[model samples]
Target: MDRTSVVEVGGIAQFIREIGPDEGASPPLVVIHGGPDWDHTYLLPGLMPVSLHRHVILFDMRGCGRSTRGLGPDGYQPEFVVEDLSQLIQALGHHTVDLLGFSTGGQVAQLFVESHRRLVRRLILASTTAYAGGDHYLVGWQEYERRLQIRAPRPAWAECRHGEGDRGVRGTVQWALDAAPIAIWDLDRLDEYLALLEGVTFSGEWLGPFREGRLHAWRPTNPEQALRDFVGPILILHGAQDMGFPVQVAQRLHAAVPATSLRVLDQAGHMAHFDQPQAWSSAVLDFLGG
Candidate 1:
């Protein structure tokens, strides 16, 4: 695996990692991380299985993780994030490629497919909502709000009152991780996942931007149109027990996208890849026709 940085739209440098196959490959699969605020680290390990089939490209979105910060106000919006993805794809020299998006990343993926349908070959959406509706779509929003209230008395929270500091956002992210229902998967893997998250460094400058770009803060302009318009093959993987994006959202998405196939992992949650690797990987590989 090799890592490189590329400047996308808005001049935000995105941290991209590539896992090349033994034989040089063409048209690599691009994996976009979720959390608008979270990094790509969590998905890195889960992608090891997919590397055997095709080269994999994983990247952190602008203002998150190792990516450059403060692309200004225009860069903080959801539409801009989709534009950044489009720019990154073009810069990488690929006219079209397979796409895998998890959770919030699915929003960007759908938007990209809608606007640039010809650029997406196959699309895989996991543990995500088709639109911004109810608490199901924004599961962590209330949790973050609750944490902010709890930490209001702290100095770090006080520092966030000025609007640009990351204290509140970082604290809220950590709290959400802590509060997430522990998975019943392999205990060792769960421990490793928790440790990786604990070591992540959140960008202070992305705090406000991340919060402002949340699905709850912005209404879904035309999700149905986007879904119905995209013609590429699509696979929807949902966890039966996912608390963040309810299974209904996945079903709804499958219904909207005429060329979609849906698979529900019985024992999985928001992190389906981690909770059910064998099932999740098999479904993806099958969809990819390997």
Candidate 2:
């Protein structure tokens, strides 16, 4: 059975949505959505397929979506999010869970695993980077835009690429709108994926700090070294042509953690789950030993 409710966790109301069976041998899979600002809604229909075999949980972190918003700068820390997930899991009666963090969510996952290592049975980091300061990502994005220019190039590409203008939410949204089409490798599925994010809401309060790179203050000084101590197995799943974080970052992560299994889907970009749903789901299910 599917269910949705508002669970008060750590004095903050969190919007939680669960799909699939209530009783099962496997622990529930708690998924963390990307965007320090975006809610859990955009992951729908794409990640919903996993519910067929396992109970899946998705929630809006503190200041996003249906969850409580307007928490000043102090309440929006990454550590607070980690603690929220920990408390939320216990409140839901889950002793342990399989966790999947996508994009920026994956960054939070790293923080989660570091402090709450024992709570996660297995972890999946998708479309994210281990290196907090992504120097290589800039080079990959240039190539991504070059390929995009061949098909459909927006006028804002030049300005957005250099980070020359304002760094406010307006500039951020404009950049995302102009470049979103090319973020997916398969142009055919672009509209289908874009449709999922319609009417989506973003937390400007959170974005203000996030855009300034202050939200990730909890990140380890050396993230690659930190991954070596994780208690559970990890799966680095990414799209070969990802424009945002880039697949090479995933490759570097895979190389750093020799125990991790890496799966890269071709003809897919940042939203690989939407681009290649079957392949993406198969990889995730197989990794969880389903």
Clash count, candidate 2: 0
Output the number of the TM-score-best candidate: 2
* Per-candidate local distance difference test: 0.69, 0.78
TM-score, model 1 to reference:
0.80
Clashing pairs in 2: none
Q: Candidate 1 — number of clashing residue pairs?
A: 0
Question: What TM-score would every model get versus the actual structure?
Answer: 0.80, 0.87
lDDT of 1 by residue, 192-243 (tens): 5565565554554545655576423322468767766778788898888676
Question: Against the hidden true structure, what lDDT does model 1 obtain?
Answer: 0.69
lDDT of 2 by residue, 22-76 (tens): 7588888999988766788777656677778878999998888789987776778
Q: Local error of candidate 1 at 112, Å?
A: 0.9
* Candidate 2 wrong stretches, greater than 4 Å: 135-143, 147-175, 211-213
lDDT of 1 at 97: 86
